[model samples]
Target: MKLPCLSIIVLAHLLLGPLSVNALGATLDSSVTSLHHGSCDINNGETNCTNIIPSPAKLHSGHSSHGMPILNMTDLEPQQRLFWEQYDTTTYWSIANDHKVMLYLHTFSLIISVMALYPISIMLSITKSPFYIPVLTTHLIVMLFSLLAFFIYEPSTPAYLYPNNAYTKMSIILFFVTIVHYVAAIVKSLSEWVIAAGTHDIVFDDDNSDTIHSISSAHDDLDIDNLEPVTGQPFETKYQNQLMANIMANKWVNSTVCSFGYLSTLVFSLFNPLLFIYHVIFVFTGVAWSFRIGMGNQVFNVLAHFIKGGVFFLFGLLTWARFIGAWADKGWAWNLNPNDETQSDEEDIGNDYEGTKIKINKKLTMEFIECFLIFFYGSTNIFMEHMANTNGAWSVKDLQHASIAFMFLGGGLAGLLCESQVVSRFLPNKKHAISFNPFGAFVIFWTGILMSQHEQEIPTSTIIHSQWGNLLATAAVFRLFTYTLLYLKPPTNAEPTRPFTEAIVSFCLIAGGLVFIQSNTETVLGMVYRGIDGMFTLNVTVGATALLMSWQFVVFAIKGWSERS
Candidate 1:
């Protein structure tokens, strides 16, 4: 009796399953058709309705001009929704795995490069070992292998293709640049070694009678009897004597190879292994992930977010580096007066020897650079903003953004003029060391205010914009404070004057830049759909910024320690 009952039930299930599925699919199609009819407009004797029903095989294939799906399960009946949900889940996992693989490969290469280049080279330099050639050779080999791995293990997805892919282009450029850098460095180092070896046997007899007599005869014009008693020694004579002495003491210091080698070493010391690796990885991750956010029809927004944000992010990092004494040798560490008497003398000597007479006012400073970049960005962005409109007519959005660009242009120009000698000559109190130009900061403040109030269709996007905007505004305020403080109590020494407010400014710019990137419409929508909130993104951004800053600090500390040792 039990076996017959089981057989009957099994037979009934087999017979009804297909019929039930077909019935449910028909019901979904009917519901979708009704909804479409209800929602779409009806013209004279004609219907203009979009078909909301999706084919089973192409449930996720429908896309809008913006590259997002036009139809999702929200418009589908229950059974259809279930089918689409399952498909989405599977697709999501596959994509996640692909991303993981790409990231893992990049991480491996980055770690290997960092380990091979950073600490080992620093130690070798400190020990003054002759194994630098081998180390560089090893690095070259590692870079070659890494490039091969990047090519071979890359994902086969269409999104990761080489042609028209910015990430791929940047990666290739970086690889070539790295190769060139290392090759040049190796050649310079080898040249120095050869020169040292060749000159090792040469000796100079400084105390020779003829040499002493020539030196005394050369200094006869500087004798006390030849100078006016009140004036002591003429400034020109003293400067010439010092310049000649320096030239005699360091004959090869101005050699092209030696200068290039010194510059390369300085660059390597500042941009250590960890910082370089992180930057490369960041470029890969940021640009590659940008494709997933869908770049079609939103090129302007994407570029604005990534490029502007990236600049500020880098600016903040450099500011932090300056605070920590990275470029102090060049007098770029934010001192009120970076110029020293000795440094000025050296510059004059170099200028005199090179026979190039440049005016002091023509020299570029950090503030001048800041103004120049702002001006450049604005001038280019004005046209870019206009390009977003395809109808050859300016929209309100275009005009609005263009107005902001105009502000930047005007402010930057004003800043440039203010820092120039033409304007400084008119001021009641003129000083070369301190700059009081506030136009750059004012531009930032105004831009932030506008952005914070900028409206968006989605609340999440608006919140994100406001978040970054507030951060930018805060940074500007802090920067103003920094300027004021510096003006009040000018630094006497040319050291890293780590203003407390600068730390805040750095954090704000970094965090704001990151948040700005996240404010893309598609990105915000995706995060919202995935239940990711603003706080989560903020926390992640802050944490990553902290980690980056800490790594930079460590690199600077190590470099300082090595130099001291």
Candidate 2:
């Protein structure tokens, strides 16, 4: 199925037309001009901007049905001919000429991104290694940068002051984020390479035998029960070896999300209350069951909490039932049968192991189902959502923005909850009361207000572009900062109520949310709702944030591989 390079180039030229014409930019410009200068022909009722009537040998100056004269350039005066030619040229070249700068920058950036990716791809091919952090990281950076550069390099908006250019402006910001990701990836890769060469660790075989021993440490007299390292740090092996659990949990979460996404879209389109209620119940039960799939590392653990919060915030009051069910389950677990405690320790261990194994198989099945759903229902929803707007349905703008805010708010809440879990694990004897962290509270309050806003009419595209667009970028930046603090901070055993870093990060997040809320001055029924104009900002911001957080996996890989080396 693979074509030769020359054939590929030829095909691209044939299909996309040389990539030299700046096709997309030119078409957009042409469409804009067509709105004003376009004329409809009576013969076919077809509209054209620069349509010329065919002349029969001689210059024809006949009056058409609309009383407009159909004349050749030869029949018109020199001044008239000059005006027509000027109009035609402007109509045609404004699109091509205006986008020329952007086209060059866009093409050059593509080359750069592709070049950066080539090395990583080659490395992966040569090593055939399961550890693909470096490769994954390079691809992510290249993707982020390419998308960002495309958005930012618009030739039409040179001044960059247009409020309606929300998509373009947001792209510019995201492009910068890609650069930051690239730098971070480089630093991380080198650190892993260094750490790999410095560590003395053993590798265990499939039969649970420690075959490879560290030359520096004599283990004959060492206490095998002590898992602590010589440096007194908690063994990172606990987290590194939990990749299977992370992968499983990630699959379950993704599947659960895709399921709910499809279900929600279906209900929205059909206006089926029964189906919606069933979807809520399914997500609630699914979320509860999925929580058991994780192996308790912070990455998987945080992800578990995120599913809960995301479901809660996205679905709102519907998930209150799930919360009640979860609480009841917790109570039931606390009051487990006393007779079950009489079982042998071996039996309990065997049961727990078997249960986890079964769940893993089920998660794999769900993962496959999720993939199908993404390509089928996921794609359908995107197309339908666009069609809804194009067909002049009541604007779903407010709902869209609210949904995005709820997602972030949910993640913020999950972050706070994850911190509590971390604290509880480090200090097992102390009962840690959950803090009503400001960031989570602020997000919750705003999300509540947003959820209640009315979506009677579509807000102006201008409003969505100018105000909330900027806020989306700002929010993503702060969220990324929170992730940076969470991942890059030194891992320690300190048992404080909360770290000062967390407080500072919380303040910044709250400030960003406030700025977002306040950015839009318009109020409906005394409540302000921020609306998103173009899908560009939200899509890129979410993607970049997710990818940036994934950098932690690269860090983990470095530690694990270095320890083994």
Candidate 3:
């Protein structure tokens, strides 16, 4: 159906005067007086700021505005959530599969890309001998499937359509595959570290017998049961060395694939994945930290690490449940019948405060170490982006800023602690670090969005709009051509192409498109005024440039196919 267009008078009245558009903390179009996005309220010169657009009068500090609710996007809409899942399967899947040629090609490309980074400065400190072989291989496999997905996947349904059949399961499977490769690698590596550290300790120790005796003695005091050696090899020189190598190879993958459930929940389950991440961290920190202590009766010597791990993990889980329930679902962790409020007098003594003051100090210590090591040191040698910026390839909106910004905080830590491997060895205690940082993501998400939005703004003109307008369009076309050329180029590249070529081509296409589209508008304005077109003639050449860039994926994919053939 055709929508009504407001006349000039109505538009002037409704638009609330010309203001620049800004969202998520970035400004767009300093020259344009009005913003397309309602959220971009006018600031002195900023496009996006915390309180700029959200006027105090319109939305009280704690209240929401008449503007779109963030939750309404998908969080509050059950059908919309379902639609996204089905869309991943029935739509993006099919299209990607259909383009299997490009899918595999890029997948292979990603493998090469990952491997290529090995010699890069980042990979040096991971291990003396590139410890990320499993990760590299897994990355390759993921790329392969990504290619299969890109080419072989079909889009039989409309945008964001939820499906109910076998396709949903298939989509879920594909989703899990990605998570399995990633999380499993981490677990394997950590596990290998445990093995290596253990065996190596025995190999190098002057008092293996004494150390082992001490540990056993401690265990006996705690009444711990014997753990059958899973290494299955006598601790002999020859066998132990061979086993060490095998274990190290096994090191990069974790034993439990519960993390696999992560992607499943992401693609199929209806809950927020943030909850899952917290739970996983809690469990990992809890169980792992427990090993640092032994089953002992003494307070100072007891398995404080394990106790700490347990408390932190458990409390975090409990806190999450309570937070989500009381705030989100308005329910308790345990359900009590609404009709059954009567309590026995004897059982009611201080019942309201049973677990309230229970603190997990031990767990908190372990969790702090866990977060510090994993988030900071462990990930430094790899992608600095904690969360992948998926949209970075196309638009300004694709970053998880907080997770990433914190990554820098992590990297700074990484620079100092690259080689140490002393590790935890036990049931955990739940303590301080056990609780989830519920609002941590909000901190990162909004900040990243703000930074990206700021970056995307069309700034005050350094060059005349008319000059750069067409140039932006032209740059977009060049981007398409260059990317297409890269695809056509053989896979045996000596190195990844330099950024300058890509940059030049993309901007030229963008400028060219802007100029071409706006030229028509300019000419029309000129005729109306009986003078040269100066104002209201949005030279739309950039429009075409942008459109072509938007469609450049088609060219890149086609070139991929041609090269493969």
Candidate 4:
């Protein structure tokens, strides 16, 4: 089905490319020389200009997600023009076009992720189906990773500050990931079915019913006490059984789960090469979020992080500069409250700080906060996903819902197929069950979504008669509402965590070992065992004092010379 569909696509492109020259941006009427901004070289009025198509940024005018984009391919510097010309043509789109493509792609990926999968049936039925496991697992990992930036982390604390195409890009990646996973599952299952048809003797000792009956085959009338039978190899002779052993030995063990060369190729699909390629674009766009995914690129990673640090520092300086200007004009600091309205739409009420000489260094504060949010969004989501996939006892429906009494399922059936313990014993993927904690990962995604969707107190919204208090209050309310829902309700439809910061928090953390120790506390006579603190307040002295007394008692009373003897 896919092959035929793809064939049509290829045929259509080839047949249409030449006929749609104008549609393809090869407008010949405009003299190509006018395109390049460099000194237009005019020779006898025949201006020499490059006939290259303009980037969306160069062609487009007005407000874009990435500020006012300068649209015109010819306006690019000579080096940039050369760079783009050498770029691969297989898939080439400027920022605006890319965003459109992303919208389509992500929808598809999400659909793919929703379906339930049959790992056991797939492993048993497919012929040469080894490739599916690795492909599926890699697609799952990278798509999930990429989503961290677009929907969740970036939305909450934008590194580049929004209107950029990151969210759109993220949606597209996830959409494709879903499509790839679904298509791969179909292929894998069919292949497995083919393999199983030709292959024989996959069953183990349990397959031999003759042995199953023989142990119980003692005549029904035989007394239970006298029914003891020979337990060694059930075959009448060893010669017959050796043949069975040979068939079993030749069978593919690892291949039973995934096909050859699957894991290695799948690993490269998104982050490594895919995200690395984006570094070039990020450089031109001046964004930092892209750097988080491409950390494996050591040289680029360091360069990007440093560049981000400088951008943040410069922003801080600009904010300070604003304060200095205000102080010079009014002999005091600006205020948070808007000048004319009771409820200003600005995130920071510059008017509210009227009498104050200096601001709280919002530039530094926002920088630190944004940076922390980025690390936090990425790290915690990764951590939570790892935990769920590894430990949570996920069921098939948990793949789609919050079905369990306490825990919720994550990664859907895909997770179970790739990483669950029992399924992995029979149906393995790249990393096995070790790193897969689907519920935790889903929580990470959910958390990112909530944060990303919640708007922050940026200055621009306030510039146009917007109330600072209103903006702040709105953001705060939205934050509190979403967070409360996340905390109170378990992510029933694909498990999600309480929030990013819940784990580090402790209101009533009941340690598993702490309660057990309480029972033993009364057993000792002289030992002073201070009970666990009821509040978050410091019981530092009491805790230390109790521990010291316990240690003294143990050392003097429990460790005597007779013990060694």
Top TM-score: which candidate number? 1
lDDT against the true structure, per candidate, is: 0.54, 0.31, 0.29, 0.28
Write one digit per residue (lDDT tens) for candidate 1, span 1-565: 1222223223222211111112223222233334332233335623344554422222333212132232332343332333233322111113444445544455455445543354455445544444445565676676666656555544545543223545555557667766766756554553454243332221112433334211222122232122222355445434433443333233243244445766665555544444454443454243334333323444555566767777777778777877787665555676633344323422532122233222232345677888888888888788677564445567666788889999989989988887776776677543433455688888888888999998664455667889889999999999999988876765555666888998888888878887787676445544433435566567667776776677667756756654554
The full ranking of all candidates by TM-score, starting with the best, is: 1, 2, 4, 3
Supply the global lDDT for candidate 3: 0.29
TM-score of each: 0.65, 0.25, 0.19, 0.20
lDDT of 4 by residue, 4-88 (tens): 2223223223211111111122211121323444433436523344643332112222121223211222344442233233322
**Which pairs clash inside model 2?**
196-562
What does candidate 3's lDDT look like per residue over 100-179, in tens digits? 45533533343343323211211221232233444445544654464355334334233333222333343345445545
What does the lDDT come to for candidate 4? 0.28
Worst 10 residues of 1 by lDDT: 15-24
lDDT-better candidate, 1 vs 2 = 1
The numbered model that scores best in lDDT is 1
Model 1: residues with Cα > 4 Å off, grouped in runs = 1-103, 111-143, 158-163, 194-291, 336-363, 426-429
